[model samples]
Target: MTHHASDIPDSFLAKWQTTTNVLAGIFDVPAGLIMRVLPGQIEVLVSSHSEGNPYEADEKAQLNTGLYCETVMATRALLHVPHALEDTHWEHNPDVALNMVSYLGVPLLWPDKEVFGTICVLDSKKRNYQDKYVELLWEIKKSIERDFVVIEQQRQLLENNAELQAALQRLTALQDELLRSEKLAALGAVVAGISHELNTPIGNSLLAASTLQCHAADFAVDMKQGLTRSRMLDFVSTVEQGAGILMRSLDQAAKLVGSFKQVVDDQSAADRRRFDLGEMVRSVLSELNHTIQGSGHRVHCAIAPGILLDSYPQQLAQVMTHLVSNAVQHAFLPGVAGTVRIAAQPDSEGQVVLTVRDDGLGIPQANLGRVFDPFFTTRLGRGGSGLGLHIVYKLVTAALHGSVEASSEPGQGACFTVVLPLSAPAPLQKPEVRAVRNGNFV
Candidate 1:
């Protein structure tokens, strides 16, 4: 596993302890040990329970010393000293103090081929270990190395799992940020459209007031010069006509301003209330009139009147806005005129089936299933954020407690149908108050 000597698990330690005890009994030795190699030292990690064993568990000794296990580790092979006292090299070794002269050991290694330590048996009398016993120790060494492989695999899995979780969290945050930006952009478009619509009526009112002022000044001069009955009658006619024009123009301007304010409030506050579906639909279409006309497209609303809904009007309006905008953007090519129709009706189940259909280039069969997927847009890099329809799906299904689907045939047209309950389910908690800051949601 390429780990330090101190990283041994308790389970592996228990297994190694059993191995050491068995080896001591099989070899009929006083001491059987599993040693671990540390930096500049060697540790007795496991020791046999046999009587008269000199070595104890956790006993440490300085490295570079003439010990039997050190010779096995340094040579990366088996070592045997049949009679340490009679040998010229290992006679005065560290274990000689305990009268452990004979020794046999095999080097142990990690999965990466790094030194771990050694497994060995020591006795106080001179004796030679058979070749079969040496082979047995080697087999045990291989078993420990296999355990190291399993540990490394488990560590890698844990690391990979943590990384995946981090990536998922980052993706979620980015999606939220993009959704906020889309909402703010939609609201901005509505504001721009309303401003453009107000210009015509307000301009007409201003012109009418200026004309009336000029007419009154001319009448005063004529009256001072001795006005006739015919001239006074003519002046009266002009005054009546100017007054009518002023009233109509001012009234139209006021209505547009009022509608704009209502839409803005509904979208910003997201308050739940009972509202007429037909009227709400008309207002949303009116707010988007500029974008529709600018694209040479038309939107027709045939929503069933008196079909009321007790739901978040803001969320429903957002759904409508995105649906209509999606049609205007994707349902036709540039400068191509098209028709988008919105219809609604109440079903027997106390639900409303609202649809937005466009008679333009319909969606292809292959892409029909993926139209509502986030960031799935055919018009990449041409002002298509790919989130318009995705936002619609979210609002309908989540906030409004509804179901929505898309259907289309190539060159026929595309339709988005949403079925929503008349009375939405109560929210689990209050919604957050949202505001726009620097063209983004805050």
Candidate 2:
């Protein structure tokens, strides 16, 4: 009853035409029709081109007492009024007015028993219809219902396919975002380390410059008071010393700044180059001197001088910075004197072994294993983003194609050891970025 004639394929409609026409001719009926039922009316779906046929396709009729389909739909069974003219109720029906006094029909059904329509034959004169006529119409009804089943299943499959494609697109988007977040986290850590390293040399240079200016002003005043050989000699010595201090401080700052620029350039390009390991380590230590300037902590380096490597120096610099900074922040309490030692040498296996050891409050044994995990920090809400060690681990293993290990016991301090090939195996890909705050990858 809910079927749309336009939704039925032309091939299926052609088949329906053949079936209805055959049934009409075999029965010698005036009309053979398939009607689709609506809420309050019936419409002709297919009408046979039989002689004297009165019904046309798409013709609408009310579901009243006179209609043959109305009776078939209500009964949900065969309706065979062989002699409607003899029946009192049918004598005044609309079919009788149309000269269709005899009818044979059966209700068509969907699989769930919902009525689809009715298939029937109408004749102008009274005649008895055999049981075979009803059975043939029922077979055609079953065939029509099978086509509806195929359509419904196809619709469901199309819906499922669309949903699957949408889900895959969402997953790809999430993966892209995750890769970007990781790159940003690495970049943030580098910026933080550079900021801390620059503070010391720049601070010392500014102080020395200010002192030198004061000494020059005093020398100017002394000269105006008249010449005295002893005073002049003392003033000259003071002025020379002040100038030396200022120049030395500024030079140290300039060296640190040069190191920073080279490291940044190498990291951004991710290229392999020749570098002296000992000098690089010393430069990094110089930048970090401010961290231990007044904390009573001492830094010791035993790097083998002239030890050179063809590798990514910037990545190595970053790893060293993280290790040293971690010691300053976590290895010791404020004002507590401790020792952080860096040692590097070549191994017999063509690899370089670098160790950063700290004598402070050592890591708890239970926490040592998880130190390199991203966002895993013991100092949450107290200045730990927990990504420093994670970045180190990633660089050593992924970018440098190297290996690292950490060993510690509570109150005995912690030590990190790294072993990398003299030359990197391949150039690293661009880093995916994520947000970082206080050293935590977010």
Candidate 3:
């Protein structure tokens, strides 16, 4: 509807003008018009003719008027004719009698659930207003519907974006909570292992102390009165036993503490170092021997003997340990054990390929993309924090300057390949940093 073009946006009013010109060419008609029907008036939104269109702007065609748009709106019916002048009920209007004759008009529904206007094509001479012409008007109505669908789609997309943002915030909160829970679980495992390590030495020391005290007192009494061979022998034996117990306890304590220190140092923020990759794998396997065996799993370590890397050894070990542990716990379906393969190979360009694969039921394709996402875990309750793979990815990409890729097919298996430098080759260490441009996706 329009009084002056300035009332609506220039772009909006201009759009209808273009539509009228384009539709006139496509329909092969003298004129094409779009009208907005109001409470007591009809307004022309479009009129393509340069000489001024026969369809008037702001002229209300009264209910019983013979004009096509007015009569069609009044009766809520379609009106099409070969010649408006020949139709007894329609040629009464001066506009039709003067020159405009053939006509086709159809309702332009408000798609917003309100009734709005009519879309029509007009010709000045007698022409065939066949059923195909009526069908042509219906097609134009559909094009109008297409525009409304686009608007509705954009509205729904914005609403979905809002919902997704809320979901992402909730996921971040859950990740913090999971980190706390993981810390506690790891702490408990450390405490349990330490207790077992300390018990064996402490118990032996207690027995040795008791025996040494009893034997020394007897030996001292015997020496004060008169020397005795049997008593001296007993004193020597007690001293030897006590010495062995003290040495054993010291040795066990030192080894346990050393391992704990190594774990801590590996995670420290320090310059990278070169280390033997093969030895690292062996050491991790030895430490987790009981766990592997208890779960009916075997450790297979064949890491090419002397492959070296200029990265943190302890961190790499942690990643491998977590992966192997994940395989043991979650690789297979319930009540089944699967072989977990771990291999490392070097290429010509000083790049190292480390592949870890499992012969167990694989991840679903829809979920494969999300597996490495922080806090995403298929095994939720059965001891999975979902951060192991996330940590692995971070270490490989930033710390080691490497790339990781994963592939899988349902019911087949999953494989994760990590490609890194054979040797960072004396390069200076640098901190990881990133810059954002138009959007911050990462």
Task: Candidate 3: give the clashing pairs.
Answer: 84-101
**Position 209, candidate 2: lDDT:** 72
Give the residue spans of candidate 1 off by over 4 A.
1-18, 48-59, 64-66, 83-101, 146-360, 363-409, 426-442
Looking at candidate 1, the ten consecutive residues that score lowest on lDDT are 430-439
Q: Candidates ranked by TM-score, best first? A: 1, 2, 3
Local accuracy of candidate 2 as per-residue lDDT tens digits, 174-208: 98797567657645664565455455557776787
Winner on TM-score (2 vs 3): 2
Q: Note the Cα lDDT for every prediction shown.
A: 0.81, 0.77, 0.67
Which is better, 1 or 3, measured by TM-score?
A: 1
Candidate 2 lDDT score at position 199: 59
* Candidate 3 C-alpha lDDT tens digits along 1-442: 3222123334544766777777777767778887776556566766766343566555555444455777666666687777867878666775575477877777765446454567787878777766776787788766765554555566569779999999999999999788667656644653554566566667777777777787788778888998878777777877997888878877766655654443223234465688888888888878878777878765576687889877777667766886777777767766676777889999998998988788887777986776665445664433344556666666566556677777887776788888888665332333233211101112
Misplaced by over 4 Å in model 3 are 1-17, 22-108, 115-143, 149-183, 199-229, 266-346, 351-422, 430-442
Encode model 1's per-residue lDDT on 1-442: one tens digit a residue.
Answer: 2365646778888998898899999999999998999888999999999978999999999988788888999899889899898998998899998899999988888777889899899999988877888888889888978887877677779789999999999999999887777656654664555455566677887888889899899999988899999998998898899888889887877765543343223233348899999999899988998988889898999886899999988788888988998898889987789999999989999999999999989999998876765445676434354556666665676567788999997787899999999999876543221211211331
